[model samples]
Target: MDYVSALLPPVVMAAFFIALVVTIVKSQGGANKAKEDAAVDAALSRAESARQSQP
Candidate 1:
């Protein structure tokens, strides 16, 4: 069982890494972009309102 014990952590980590990569590869692009754009727009609008409120 020495060999199995020595290799088990690496094997489990490798499996988790592979699963993370697969999830990233299968993910969507459109909704994320839209979310980012909305966030930026909100920030910009808030800044514009702040500037208008200034003397």
Candidate 2:
């Protein structure tokens, strides 16, 4: 029916969005978590040091 057709796309998109979120959540905080965090910290520190040196 018209209502079923209208609702189907939204339902399908929501299901895929939920799956994507679940995959992202599961991929986080494993063996690479510390490595990723260190990389971020290093980048931030480098930026801060550069900003301090600018003036």
For all predicted structures, in order, the TM-scores are: 0.55, 0.82
Cα distance off (Å), candidate 1, residue 4: 0.3
Best candidate according to lDDT = 2
Candidate 1: residue pairs that collide:
none
- In candidate 2, residue 46 scores what lDDT? 100
Cα deviation of 32 in candidate 1 (Å)? 5.2
Error of 2 at 37 (Å): 0.5
Overall lDDT per candidate, in order of appearance:
0.90, 0.97
RMSD of 2: 1.2
Q: What's model 1's lDDT at 50?
A: 100
The backbone clash count of each candidate, in order, is 0, 0
How do the residues 1-55 of candidate 1 rate in per-residue lDDT, one tens digit apiece?
A: 9999999999999999999998887664666878878899999999999999999
Query: Candidate 2 lDDT, tens digit per residue, 4-26?
Result: 99999999999999999999998
- CA RMSD per model (angstroms): 3.8, 1.2
Lowest lDDT sum, 10 consecutive residues, model 2, at 23-32
